[model samples]
Target: MASDPFDRPNRNSSSFILVGVPSLETSPICLGILFCSGYIITLVGNGGVLLVIGLDNSLRDPVHCFLGMLAVIDVVMVTTIVPKMLSVFWLNSTQISYMACFVQMFLVHSTTSEESGVLLAMAVDRYVAICHPLRYQAILNRQTIAQIGLAIVVRALLFMDPLTGMVTKLPYCHSHVVPHSYCEHMAIAKLACANPRPSGLYSVAGSSLIVGMDMAFIAVSYGMILKTVLGKKSCWKAFSTCGCHICVILLFYVPGIVSIYAQQFGSGISVHAQVLLADLYLTLPTVLNPIVYSMRTKQIRQAVLKMLFSRKVHA
Candidate 1:
């Protein structure tokens, strides 16, 4: 039988569970409405991104292909965490079964890692196209893109597997009430009775290695791309083409970096603030990615319009 973490006795029982954090105070009606709205928006936006990329032959190139995979990853990630989280909030239940909690932890971490990998792959794609235009098609062919996507999934699975196992193995002698909204690694680790130094060390080390290497590669790639773009006669046009990608990169990376540091260093930020920021990181990309592609990429916009109008005509 699985032990209940909350039932465990501790000296600082009051502090074991977070105090002063505002409870979910909204009426059930409001909670239901908000949950439905969030789910619908995320689903439609991510679904549209996948549909547009898949159906439009012109958008099947290396860059859009990567973007499409990102859309899929976002959809999977949100589906895994947000709905259940909304349930917890609406029901006002801080308790999650040990197995369910670990499963959620695994899915969230895996998808997040995969998303980071996908972003890094997109950066490499941009680097190849802008910095080495002549070799772009040859290097980033269809098979190569598929291979990169596979690599992202494989890497995420491998990286998160051991961490999930480590987390599930820890004795939960503290309170089960997670400090934050989700089953995040840091939050869960704090509840463990076992010495979490190893887990913390592993998390920081692994995250730093992966994020650092990826960021370095992206930085080098962008540096070369900038040099190449500046050398071009139509530098403005070159910049315009890469602008959307740059926007997406910044949007995805900046919040992630902020959240990681805030969570790690025990910044004095309130639990509510951290939860809101974490939700934003999970959601914004789902909403923004499709909008950015539709507005910025002429091919994607035309494809979306054609699909919408065709559906209307058929109806």
Candidate 2:
């Protein structure tokens, strides 16, 4: 009680059990294979993006830098949750130690919050490029970009630190069985012997203030970008520049909002459907982010293609 259990976990059992996709009980093998394929695709795509960006000196613009950052975020995000989910499905090994659960929940939440901030930063980069093209380089130089990255990291750390403390301090008593596929704040907190209301409230507040503010900033940035490029050709080009990022944003945030709302308010949707939505929110972006960026951004595609071609030539 004096110090948090996160200093060391005290648990009812040796490990917590994850009841992953109860709906897949009849077809666990197939579901596991599907998820494994998804995870592999995500790795290959994002890895390729990172490789392309790192190899090309000409592609070192702020946009490319952010793309690499996003790829890293997507990679880490999937790595945090998907492996355990796959293990649960394939190996029937659902028991995760409390410390492991704590680590997973921390990485998952922090990376998610950081990615939201990165999305806002990307919007700002686009706004500068479209509206203040002449000043874009001066405004978003390497130092400035580094500063933005640092700020995003610190913001994520500060925002999620309290939530981690709240979730970790609670005494988990008899029930160590988490109903979900992976360790999340609510899932872990519900196992606590003490009240879990504060953890839930903290999560809701974190989503509203952290994610909500980032979305608001991105929206305002895009609005200004639209005004700056209102003419026929300018409008097309400007929107073209940001089109991929917009799609990625929508993919990342919209499903999460819908899933949260459905879970909270939509009585008509089934529990399994809600869980599926939650899973998709994390996995969908990882799978599609590279495709959307590489296809829409010509420079990225060219860079990736050139690198692959050279590798094949040397081999």
- Tens digits of per-residue lDDT, candidate 1, 1-315, equal 977655555544433232112354444456546656776887898798788888877787887888788788888888877666666556555556667777877887788788888878877887788778899999999889888888988988888888887877888765666766567788888778788767767777777777778878877877677778796786877676567666766676666666666777778876667666666676677667666644566677788899999999999
The 10-residue segment with the lowest total lDDT in model 2: 4-13
Q: Candidate 2, which segments miss by more than 4 Å at Cα?
A: 1-11, 237-244, 260-269
Per-candidate TM equals 0.83, 0.90
Top-TM-score candidate index: 2
Q: Local error of candidate 1 at 177, Å?
A: 1.1
Measured with C-alpha atoms, the lDDT of residue 113 in candidate 2 is 85
TM-score of 1: 0.83
Instruction: Provide the overall lDDT of each model, using Cα atoms, as 2-decimal numbers.
Output: 0.73, 0.82
Which portions of model 1 show Cα errors greater than 4 Å? 1-38, 231-234, 237-244, 312-315
lDDT of 1 at 228: 81
